[model samples]
Target: MGTVGITGDDGEFHLISMWVAPEARGTGVADLLLHAVLEHAGVGGGRIRLEVTEGNIAAERLYLRHGFRRTGVCGTVGGDRPEFEMVLDL
Candidate 1:
């Protein structure tokens, strides 16, 4: 119901993508997927980063609860949707 992946090398990792089916929200699927990604990234003592869409409070809260902090970096998705970067030191 959910999945997440990482990219990058030499310890620095980026959460390339994460998604949980709408029907699976609040069912622990997202947590499981995030845990798996963190486990993989924790092999390196660097940091894991990801861009979350602005206004997606649920996702933002999930990352926050997982210890991710906003990095003050911002961007856009598809040339319109706003997004910001967050990081979790592993």
Candidate 2:
């Protein structure tokens, strides 16, 4: 298992670091956790955002199915891997 963070910045919430346990993969755990996070953002009147590695096609598709649009690409903060920034309007 990993962790997720929803940070408030100037009254807007940003969703980050969403990951599922290896044993939970393909079990709809990611979708359920993402939906719950989005619901929480909605209740707070904020939007959700996250970054996924460019090579992660499955995650990209999952976010797309969840209504998260690709906003832009960004460099990883402390790593060499590139990432795509996605946002969900809640």
Candidate 3:
């Protein structure tokens, strides 16, 4: 299990910082977490958004499969890693 962020931003819900345990990979844990977040976003009439490192193709694919389209690119807050900003309409 991991933590997923659900916060209010400008009256909208935001989903972020979702991660799963290494041993839980491929066990649908991430999918379940994402679904829960999406459900919460829908209830709050907000879109779901997240950023992932460009090199994390697996995560990108998973987000895409869940209808999160790439919107833009964002720099890591304190690091040099490049991240892709994605959003899913609720």
Ranking by TM-score: 1, 3, 2
86 in model 3: Cα distance from truth in Å?
Answer: 0.3
Per-residue lDDT value at 58 in model 3: 81
> Deviation in angstroms for 32 in model 1?
0.8
Which candidate achieves the best TM-score against the true structure? 1
User: Candidate 3's error at 78, in angstroms?
Assistant: 2.9
Taking the tens digit of each residue's C-alpha lDDT, what string does model 1 give over 1-90? 877878987889999899899999999899889998888888867899999999999999999989999999999999999999999998
**Model 2: per-residue Cα lDDT over 1-90, one tens digit each:** 545667775437777677788887888888888777777778756577788887899899889999999887676855787887998876
Clash pairs, model 2 backbone: none
Off by over 4 Å in 3: 9-11
How many pairs of residues in model 2 come into backbone collision? 0
Candidate 3 local lDDT, 1-90, one digit each (tens)? 766877776436656688899989898998998888877677756577778887899899889989989887677845877887888877
TM-score of 3: 0.85
Better of 1 and 2 by TM-score: 1
In model 3, residue pairs whose N, Cα or C atoms come closer than 3 Å (at least 3 residues apart or on different chains), thus clashing, are: none
RMSD to truth, every model: 0.8, 2.0, 1.8
Q: How good is model 1 by TM-score?
A: 0.95
Could you tell me every candidate's TM-score relative to the true structure? 0.95, 0.82, 0.85
Clashes of 3: 0
